[model samples]
Target chain A: MAEARRRILVVEDEYIIAVDLADALAESGIEVVGPVGNVARALAVIEAEPLDGAILDINLAGDAVYPVADALRARFIPFVFATGYDRSAIASGYETVPRCEKPVDGKRVADLLFRSIADR
Target chain B: MADDSPAAAPSPGSDELLRVVIESATDFAIFSMDPSGLVTGWNTGAERLLGYSETEMLGRSADAIFTPEDRVAGKAEEERRVATAEGRAIDERWQMRKNGDRFWASGLMMPLSAPGLGYVKILRDRTEQHHTEMRIRESEARFRLLATNIPQLVFRAQADGRRSWGSPQWIDFTGLSFEDSMGFGWLDAIHPEDRDATLAAWNDAAEIGEYYVEHRVRRATTGEYRWHQTRARPIQTGTDDRDVDWVGTMTDVHDLRELQGRQQILMAELQHRTRNLLAVTQAIAARTLRASASLDAFSTEFAGRLRALSRVQGLLARTDQGAIGLRELVWGEMEMHGDIEGRVTITGPTVTLTPTTAQTIGLALHELATNALKHGALAHDEGRLGIGWDVAATRPGYALVLDWCESGVALPHGRPRHAGYGSELIERALPYQLGAMTRLDFTADGVRCRITIPLRSANHG
Candidate 1:
């Protein structure tokens, strides 16, 4: 039997960017979970989904994405930050987390996510 | 040599030596006054100091040398009484000379019990020393006046930033008493986070000769913390560094610092927004290109979408707080297509939106109006478009419910372009971007779309 497609979740607020990111992830033959726009929905996905990594935007609407990040960390689910903020603005313990800074393409996001999560 | 003890009676040779010493002392006028205050003996020093020879001043009242004010105040008699009772009396006053000039005189009077020696007086001119003391008194009074009245909180500290004194303003602002503010007690009034840095600045001040730090200080009345610029400088007690005392002020700079901080935040926000806008614009272009049939179609669609995005960016930029009204967004979007003076009706309460909500929603309104102009109501002169919005109460808070109605036009006879970019934005992007609930209906007469944006979404900064 063919193995299940690798699943990845996207948490971004902007509409066009989210669609573009979702399309890019889908094109890579990866089963994309969501481009959930806020922290609450992102956390729901983290709790329900299994078996892969995630891409997170540092700012979800007006809320920090750290709670989602903390959830991901507690589950040992690997993730990378796609953010507009610099390292200093990120919460501590997340400064060292790999980041694909804002205005980056989906391929860069996907590649960084896979590289960080390949072992798991 | 054998009679060298000071308490012993003077030898004959020593008494002669004392007479010579007394007569030659030009600064001290040694003289004897009789019981009636008459001058009975005088020396050369007396003639030099008082500008009088023995012949001129002999038998004259010693009161003649006292200033008129001092004599009128009975200072001469008071000196005599004090000397008789106390064995020695010291008096300092402005005395008159034979030429009518004046000098400050510090005098000592002693009563001698030996015969013919009623009182012995020694006088020394101390005019320069008296002038110096007077100058110091006047300067000290001026310093007190300035320090107390100035708006800044004045303080005096040692070289190591130990508080020696604080002005009344300190007590009034920090609620710290004079005693409580002594030593490290004043540090309690400083914000704990700022104290370490403030102390560091003071520690450096000893070598740098100045102390300067900005910190939060607690206000006694409101118990609020306000930013204060604390500064001090060594008072320069001497050449030695350890003898230094510092005088400084703590000036309230909360408002000024807050303004500067807000300006910096605005600058950073502008930079972040510019970058985010560029990202959104890129996505719009990419999506438009994928939906277009050819390069020409892509150019037309992409340009329209960019214009919509740029217009909202303009609206957002002009506003200090990015507050875009619902009516203004709809009216401006409709007006961009053509003359919307009477053809469009927009009604709404004062509904404000954040920049992100306005940007995507502005584009959605642009697309709806564009479609109406191309195929719906505005395509015919008989067409009418009505747009209205109101903030309706929702479960948690309130949500803005906007209605767009296009009437007096026959519906498209063929299938609806459900897969197009405009439909995708209205049906999908609105919900994802603003967390809005939207319904687009293909009614027989025209198209009616209702967009409900929950105010609880990411619309706030």
Candidate 2:
């Protein structure tokens, strides 16, 4: 039997972006987890689910996703941010993490997250 | 002392008519004195005006009516000596009455015969008029003190824009002298653009009884135009309402306008909204590409979605409350296709959504209705579509519960859940953006979606 595929969580507040991103990840032969939309739900999923990596949109609706980003960091999981905001919006501790500015493509987000995980 | 009786008006028997006229001339105190300045003659007018009768005044010195200070200063003797040489000496001064009350007396003395001789005199009391003039002088001094010391620039003007005077504060603030500020010269210190409006307000003051205007006035030190509020009120002159004069003041309000500060903030906000909108357009195009079978199909679907986005942006732009109503969002998408007068029913308790939430939900609604028109309930005449929403309590807070259902249609086989854009937005976007709880059921009859989204004014992160 083949080894289990990596389960990557997609945390994006925009529905179309999340669906497209989630579909793109699935097309690449990886097991995709939730594309949770809010900070609280994303935190819950991060706490309970088994994940290889995650992608985040810095703003979920109007609330910043820093708390969710903090949770992923606490668990030692690697993730990349997709944001309409500039790089300065991210917390200083997570400054070194990759950022893919919106109008962002899924492949770039995936590559950045997996690369971040491998480096760690 | 009794040399000449010519100072008396006349004997009663010789000029009875003249004597009666003199006696009854109650406004004047007609009396005479001999060359020695003693009281030699008296009349009833003198008695009434001076509070003295002929019996009490006879043989008394004419100087008896002089005030103590005037007598001490020899004013009575000097007047008599001047009258002897000049034919008449006129003086108005404080004189005493018999009861010790003081009256302001206007008196004239001339020589009874020649210089260094006794003199005749005439007197009139003007005490009430003098008191009134003194009161006016005192109030004017008090007003001058207040106007100069206040921080605001004060002025006196006619109903026209012509100013009669400006306070010391006005002169100091505008660097304009009393000469330069007179008439319409004060307009030179106001901003050119604001002068016309200020003058117009001033012109209307006659009918309105007041002048009020907000304009820019130049500060003399900095030579900069600053915002100032000027107000003037008419002071009516008693019964006739004529002889009106205006009292006005100008107060600086430069900091309150804050025009530049607000413009900078709006610039930043505009940039942010623009960037976010572009990102949204990119997302729509990408998804439309995924769901289409051909380039032509992609173009049509993508265009429709873009129009939906534009409509929502239009709604967002016009909303003064920074929110869009739920009913507007739904009908906005539905009406874009055509009127859903009979085919679709929408009911909801009015609720508002934030810009971010409205944008996301608007896309979801577009896809839902579009899908129905193309392949679902809206495609069949027998099908029915119902949309309803109401507020309900949830764990964290209250939320808007919305139901979208289509009946009298069969779910097409081989169409997998979450395989298309409509289902994706409904199932994923709503939950992501609003923390919404949603359910989409593809049953034996038709498609149904229920969503619960929390209600709150949006907060910008």
Candidate 3:
């Protein structure tokens, strides 16, 4: 059986970081979705697209991305958190989601995204 | 007409009676002066006070006893003119005596006119009373100086709350002049928020004739409000059944009040830090104890871990309570093994780790790096380790990925039958505290451990 190409969404505010992550994922042969930087655009992409999984930045322009986390949860799309802050700074409800700290390795990005999609 | 009057009776007995009366008086100086202002009669009072006997003064001109300046200014002529025109003249002035010394005197000159003779004048002296009045005036001047120089805003007010006298100190302290500090002007200097209560307190005290004390005033320099204690009380008896004057003072106590506020905040911060430290220590102890087989083993392991913690804490203290750079902390832990010159390569952009995160990660990294040095890859000089991390994009969170990769060490025969303290702590304890997913891989060539800590638990330094 041929390996299925996983669809992943990247939500990051910083322009360079978002581009780096998308390029890294695409190089790993995974299909990259919208690398949206704001909450409204991220939510619209999630609703319009067929996303298998996602990577989310904890802060977007000084506001939290919990609403995106909530929408992903409702859609049963597994997502991982990427942050510079420690775990204590995250809200209590989202504690169980997988998290990766920067600077992320290209291979680990492939592995974690593949695992999150396969688990879903 | 002269023979009909008692003065012209020419009785030797009447003359003796008059002499007896004049000589016996102590408080009054009775003397007679002729129309030319000469001393024609003198009594015992004049003899004792003026230091002149009645016989010596009887023929002398009264002008001889006046001060040189008063004589030059025609004071004697002025007195005589008033006496002749107004029948009697009263003057309070400096007078000279037989010794040419001056005394403040209240003198009265009365003109005595008979039917056929020239006018006779009666003079009375008042030097003693004048001295008492001078002393009283001096005392009042001293009191005024004291009130003006006090550090507080000293003031005097009438019974109706009208300010009568405000000290110069008020101008010095409030930068307001005497006129500006009176009545409602004083209330204007008070902070608007505190003005009503301060006025009410003053009014109540004034109505009941009690001491008024209030703490509400504005600072002179900044126009910022400050606490002041203003106190006032009636200067005289309140029960005198008359209008009373009140004397008061105001003192600045803002510094004392501010010190008390700072002390309270410091006390609260101390309490919070104590509780947080206790919680962190308890967590460390519980995790260490649970991972040990025996108390002896636990003690040794815990001691080593605490020593590592203390080393990191010392480094942080040197930085003056600021975040320690991640690269520095990692390099510091590795250098403790004595020789890591070519074996370990740490790379990353400068990331500042919070103190709590630094200690946790410092200990975790210390244990892993120690294990690798002792048995895994870094034990061999040919081995190389790459330690690096960067931020990743994840929804509503950040991912920090740290890698420990080793090369050129001989492979372990198989994964160890039992996981050791270092393995369990890196895989379990760190994830629990840091909310990161940790992975440990044992390969034929070297060991690799990766930790992805969430930003929430790991961002602050």
DockQ for each model: 0.57, 0.25, 0.02
- The TM-score of candidate 3's chain A against the true chain A comes to 0.93
In candidate 2, stretches whose alpha carbon ends up further than 4 angstroms from where it belongs are: A1-9, A25-33, A45-54, A71-79, A88-97, A111-120, B1-273, B380-384, B393-396, B405-419, B441-446, B457-461
Q: Share of real interface contacts recovered by each model? A: 0.57, 0.47, 0.00
- Name the candidate that leads on TM-score: 1
Show the colliding residue pairs in model 1: none
Stronger candidate by DockQ (1 vs 2): 1
Across residues B1-461, which tens digit of lDDT does each residue of candidate 3 receive? 76699987766788798788878875566677777777888778877667778888887877766789999999987887787788788888887778987776677876777522223433456566665556656755776888877777787876545677778777766777788877767666777787667667767886677656556676688787778877788764232447467877788888888897787655644443343334344445555686788999789777777767777777777886557778888888888777787777888766777665677788878787777877877788888888998777577677777888877878776676777666766775565445568998877778888888777545633
| Residues B77-181 of candidate 2: C-alpha lDDT, one tens digit per residue | 888778876789998889998888899888887776644446667888878767766765676677788888888899999889799989988888889899999
Error of 1 at B25 (Å): 4.9
Q: What is the TM-score of chain B alone in each candidate?
A: 0.74, 0.55, 0.65
lDDT, candidate 2, residue B293? Answer: 91
Weakest lDDT window of 10 consecutive positions for candidate 1 chain B: B235-244
lDDT per residue for candidate 1 within B1-461, as digits (tens), equals 75777768755688689788888887799998997789988888889989989898889898988888989999899998888889999988899889888999999999978744689899999898888777766765676687789999998888788898889989899999999999989999999999999999988997888899999999999999999998998764433455567889999999999899798766766655776787788888888877778999899888888888888877876778778776677777887887877877888777779888898898898788778888888988888999998877799887889898989989865448554676778899999888789998877788888999899533422
